[model samples]
Target: MLRSTIGGLLIAFLAFGTAAAQTYRPAFDPGALKGPRAGAPNMVMVLGTPHLSSFPESFDPDRLGGLLERLEAWGPQAIAIESLSGPQCDFMRRYPERYRDTVEDYCWDPAPARAATGLEVPAATAEAKRLLASWPEEPTPSQRRRLAAVFLAGGEQASALVQWLRLPETERQVGNGLDDVLVARLETLEGRRNENTLIAAPLAARLGHERVYAMDDHTADAAVSDKEAYGKAIMAAWDNPAVAKRKALDDALADEIGTDEGVLVLYRAYNRPVLAQLAFEGDFGAALEEPSPQRFGRRYLGYWETRNLRMAANIREMLGFNPGMRALVIVGASHKGYLEAYLDQMHDVHLVDTDTVLH
Candidate 1:
């Protein structure tokens, strides 16, 4: 009799647990559901692609080719790129001829000539160098440190050191020292540089001459410098009386972006938020859990969660700008889960499976 009672109680507990889980909707936003009409533009397709590689062995053109084919077939009126930004847009609008000339200079400059080295570099590297060189002044120490971080994250230790040295004295301090931890991190990133480039190129080729937009608002590093200041700025913008009146229109604009053009945004999977929640709930404390299930119970989960939330928010806002705009967000694989879930909650957005694309 006691065993029967225990079993019944266990079943009840399980049912209650399931109910609680169901109640937890990460993307739930009452305002998004009915706040305003999304006058969607035309068609929006969001896609996530694999990372780029230096050599053919590291490349995955077939996967990228498939994505391009889909975009071409869809025939978007204006395809926005992940590489263009608002400031650049302003520059282009204000100085079309000068902007064209600058872009041409970068594209036309021989890799060896620009870097003043005989190193056989990829087009992305060449382009990045040109862009970096053309800036008004040398990068600040913080900027150099950020570049080092990028190199470290990308597994390019040598490049990180090279970039670090190129910066002024103040910036080099940000790297601190050539410690083992920093070295190992850079080595890992160096290994992945080839892969990063290969993934970005074909997509750029396909978008050809259209309005490829760079959505990065220069906020990541800015936030790093002054988090409170950045928050205040965003808040101030939001609190402006002019902005408050246009909230509905802004929401509508987001929707329009989704329906207008097929857009893709990429992010590293190791940066997701659910993985953080899982880690906090699991054995590991605040420290980043290792990438082993036996030790960390699927260590990459938190990273994936962080990446997804960020990417989804970006996609959602961009889509809100125009309905019917198809956006393709290319991010690390682990982030796929959260992005898929978040986008699914939207009224008509479709989440394309990366596994399907990979297969």
Candidate 2:
């Protein structure tokens, strides 16, 4: 009788648990409430790419001619890159304890431009906008040079490069607020092999754009109390089969990027729909299960998501100002999935199929 009573109670508890699980549902879903949006929808293509700096020293800029041709044909009215904005860097500078490394690595000091223009990041940014707002349709070499100087002062080197590139080779000399120091900086930027200078800036120039938007964010950085232990915990979590496979795939792709076809193939693989799930499994998923008492994995995941969310918001804000325009975003491969998912939730934004564009 006692055994039978115990068995009956266990069955009753299981039945109640099942019933509760089946009845659970969320009260609200913002993703489902996409609405009666005004004007034409914004079109965005997020291009996932490996950092060009990782390429071999022999990597020629001409190797990218084919990739550049396709992007130019896409004709994006606006271009955004994975770079920290000057204003954000300035803001982060105040909190040096948390962001010293981030600022040093990502933000270019505008001291030279500041000296030439006598304006800080804020004023220079405002001046760049004001000049563009009333910019002449047929701006002279002098005007372009002046704007480039202002853009440099504003901490937008890529945009400044656009102006410098648009000018005739002979007209690229020091003048129109661009002193000797500023001219030298632009010259150095022209030979840079990184994506912003080689890809985004050149593409913007080819498409007759005045500037490229910097939408990356790193303000999510937090100084861990036990930095050494935190690093060890995260590294231990990453030592899984999924991570090994991801590394193998990345290594293989990096080797094949010698030609145009190779570059396109690499891009296609990175932007595959399944790559997102694979990335989560190898990275954030593994981290979430880390056995560290400090919860370092969860902390890393939080920072990753926060950065991507802020980046998506910056992109969305840019689109909001210029509705119905086509925009292309260039970012690291890891960020592609998170950015697309976040931007998809917006009512007026339409994500262009990356595969279609790459093809």
Candidate 3:
């Protein structure tokens, strides 16, 4: 009688347990993705790429063809590029005097382009809106030649491209009426001197897209405090040993860039989340976390985060214009993790699996 009673209790407990299991709810629900602003959640995928000029001389293009094809095949509704454009470019153009010192020291040469456009930097800068607004839908081949010339002259390549694609397809030929200087420049770009020319614009053109989003943020780039002091503080506080080790790894990777397979390997590693975290660590890890008088590390981290936050916001706004969109962001590898972290916070945003795309 005791054994039978115990068996009955066990059976009852099992039945109750089975019922509870059947009623359990899962953590994920498709309904959670749909928000008030969007009919369905939008997906974001951030791809980290090496800066175009950062690659070694022996870098191969053949290997990247497959990668490019896959990305194009994925057919994202929108693609965000890392170039300084949209409002940031407007700010730079409006107050060249304020930003010129830094920009000229590092990147961009508007001289050749300005000279070719027959307008001074400030004059050409002022005309961007007018030109883009009135740009041709099907530009003559000579017009494309002229735009290519402008590119050689150092005109804003992104804006120039915006104007170029409006023209007819046949009018966009590079060699037509273009001198060797312009032709050479076109060849250099086709060979992938910069990601704008090498990948972003061309891929967009292939996909029949009209414009690419310029998502870079430079608002927090200016250092407010004693710049020299901040610099010194960071170098002193940072883990120099880690920096040296990363440099060694970078050097090793640089050596492998010559072959197509090697380039993909390098890029895949670059796009990894671990790599982005490592980048964050190198950029401000020790300085911000350690005890210090200057605390420049924290300040630096603050600026970086601010810039990334704004960038992510810009992307979100872009998505707001279209419902249920999938956007692909191509940015410098360092920005990948930050962008992803911030973008993931949006209520209706979904981050696509980068691992699947990359692998």
| Model 1 misplaced regions, further than 4 Å | 1-46, 54-67, 76-205, 208-303, 348-359
Span of ten consecutive residues with least summed lDDT in model 3: 147-156
Global local distance difference test of model 1: 0.40
Model 2, residue pairs in steric clash: none
Model 2 lDDT per residue over 16-38, tens place: 99998999888876556664466
Model 1 lDDT per residue over 259-305, tens place: 11211222211223443333243322322333322322222334334
Clashes of each: 84, 0, 12
Candidate 2's C-alpha runs over 4 A off are: 1-29, 32-38
Candidate 2 deviation (Cα RMSD): 4.1
List lDDT for all candidates, in order.
0.40, 0.90, 0.67
Best by lDDT: 2
**Candidate closer to the true structure by lDDT (higher is better), 2 or 3:** 2
Q: 270, model 1: CA deviation in Å?
A: 17
Sort by lDDT, best first.
2, 3, 1
What is candidate 1's TM-score against the reference? 0.35
Q: Candidates sorted by TM-score, descending order?
A: 2, 3, 1
Alpha-carbon shift of residue 303 in model 2 (angstroms): 0.6
Which is better, 2 or 3, measured by TM-score? Answer: 2
- Candidate 3, 243-349: lDDT as tens digits: 66667767888876766667667777787767776776676676567555766788778877898998898898889888688788888888888888788767778
